[model samples]
Target: MSKLLGLGIAATGLAHFAAPAAFEPVTKLAFADDIRNWTYRNGATELAIGLAIAAAPTRKAGFAGLAVYAAWLGKRVLARR
Candidate 1:
């Protein structure tokens, strides 16, 4: 389960790097003209988190990734307000 989730995350991250333009629509609303830059940065973060989870499929690593993602989501939510 952990490996599957990690692979999914990693794949998405790789997509961000490989086809950043495809993600423009989603990111454009948040970053505007800096969509490319934002995508790349986000991709790197996602890749790292995914790799971490894959490398260590432990409860601690899972929680760490979840916490990071939750924090990011929280920030986005707060920013929208």
Candidate 2:
């Protein structure tokens, strides 16, 4: 399960790198002029977290990934307000 989840996350990161332009709109509101760069950085961060989860495949790793994801989600939610 962890491996699958990790792979999914990694795939998403790869998608960001593959088509940063497509993601630009999602971030344009927050990063008007730097959306592309921001997307790339986000992709890199996601890739690292995905790799970490994949390498450990332990409860700790899963929790760590979840925490990071939750933090990201919280940040996005807060930004909307």
Q: For residues 1-81, what per-residue lDDT tens digits would candidate 1 score against the true structure?
A: 777777777788899989998977766655555679988977877777777776664546755876877587567646765
After superposing candidate 1, which stretches have Cα over 4 Å from the reference? 57-59
Candidates in order, TM-scores: namely: 0.75, 0.72
- Name the regions of candidate 2 deviating beyond 4 angstroms: 29-33, 57-62
Point out the worst 10-residue segment of candidate 1 by lDDT.
54-63
Q: Candidate 1 overall Cα lDDT vs. reference? A: 0.74
lDDT of 2 at 22: 85
Q: Output the worst ten-in-a-row residue range by lDDT, candidate 2.
A: 54-63
